[model samples]
Target: MIMKTEKRKSVEDYLCSFPEKQRDLLNQLRMLIKKTMPQMEEKLSWGAPTYVLEGRYCLQFAGNQKHLGFYTSPATIRQFQTDLKPYKTNEKNTLQLRWDQPLPEDLLIKMIQFRAEEVRRESLK
Candidate 1:
């Protein structure tokens, strides 16, 4: 007997699965990550849109019921704890971006850049 495997969804498909507002927020985050690190490979990882560098997770984002979750290394979150004070964060390395609030573009860029550097450093070791 032959069995068929489930098809994995692309980032675009995942984004489209959301409501219009959530989709827009997810797209905006996706575009920002792409613009920040065009070299990083983008794909669905852990059921979210993930950006990879040197085969390591650079960053990931997902649309939640009330907020968009920006995930990265805990170190990155600790590094930006001061800057991230205005936003809500959890110990699990998630930075919550509420739909009602403006996207913190500059801060996101900085966090992604820092994550990219971390990936590079890990690749070296």
Candidate 2:
């Protein structure tokens, strides 16, 4: 049997607020996270689309004029620092994916998976 999907707010509304080009990219990113962690809670947090698991924030993604921002915990950033070194990042644990370059889907998937496990560990502590 086919299961119907319920519509989510805030994140959808936020994606709609962007231009088509950026909107498409944001949509793809959102879907990827949802596919990877269907049980995670999603909402608008800190002016971006955030995912939380078991009361702990797992990840967040935002779109900018020139790039997309992927936000996660500092531990994740440090853990993936070598792989993420090619991208621009900040001390706040955000990785910037430029509009001019291709999206690193594999790296992102790894980061999301890592964050999900981290969130789980946090909730247990």
Candidate 3:
């Protein structure tokens, strides 16, 4: 017997699946990304909202129960470690943005810009 794989939902569907609070937070992040990097393509990747540039992954974010997961390249995380000190971060590329805290718009913009530049550079190579 042959089996079929389930299709993943679009980014909009993924966002809509979350609760109101999480949805609002995710939308804020999405808007910020769109504003900062209008050229990047938005898609659903790894069950989350991902921004891509030149067919390369720029950044991705997912809503969790207590925090939103912000993911980028490890190099970008290391570059902004000091600014991210207050937030919870993993050894890899994940940064946890707590729901109770305000979104660090400026810091997130810098991180997103860094990823965009990195993706652009990689695309040229």
Candidate 4:
């Protein structure tokens, strides 16, 4: 419900082109994001699906060479550093969420929720 009809269609088409396993993973992640933060807005930006909350870009995700990468603001990176310790992260505060392996669902939900709160705080300032 957070996403517009057109945007949601685009995301569905994009994920459908992948294999079943990949599709399953992407769809699950998409659902988690949408359900966890219904106040956020979803869009396809920069050739990837992005989520905006409280007027700022809160999260971005994309297909990767060997994994799916989820982009988070620097604040989330700093706050979740300990929780994200096991992931292959780049210098830019992006955490690589691998698709071939089972994602740490609980961790992902926490991360997304943290990001949602951060965006709300930023929008207020």
Question: Candidate 2, residue 85: CA error in Å?
Answer: 1.7
Task: List model 1 lDDT by residue over 6-108, tens digit each.
Answer: 4548987787777777788789989999999999999898887888898887888978777899999899999999999989998678999998887999999
Q: TM per model?
A: 0.91, 0.87, 0.90, 0.85
Cα lDDT of model 4 overall? 0.78
* Residue 101 C-alpha lDDT in model 3: 80
Alpha carbon deviation, residue 65, candidate 2 (Å): 2.5
RMSD of each: 5.7, 7.0, 5.3, 5.4
Q: Pairing residues by index, what is the TM-score of model 4?
A: 0.85
Candidate 2 local lDDT, 1-125, one digit each (tens): 11123443677778877777777888888998998889999988887799989888889998876789999988889989999989999867899998667678888889999989988988888
What is the Å distance of residue 38 in model 4 from its true position? 1.3
lDDT of 4 by residue, 1-125 (tens): 02122433466666765677777877888888988888888887776788888678998877665787888878788887898888887657698877668878898899899988888887888
10, model 4: CA deviation in Å? 1.3
Tell how far residue 80 is off in model 3, in angstroms.
Answer: 0.4
lDDT of 3 at 90: 78
Task: Rank all candidate structures by their lDDT, best first, as comma-separated numbers.
Answer: 3, 1, 2, 4
Clash pairs, candidate 1, are none
Highest lDDT scorer = 3
Collision pairs in model 2: none
Name the runs in model 2 displaced over 4 angstroms: 1-9
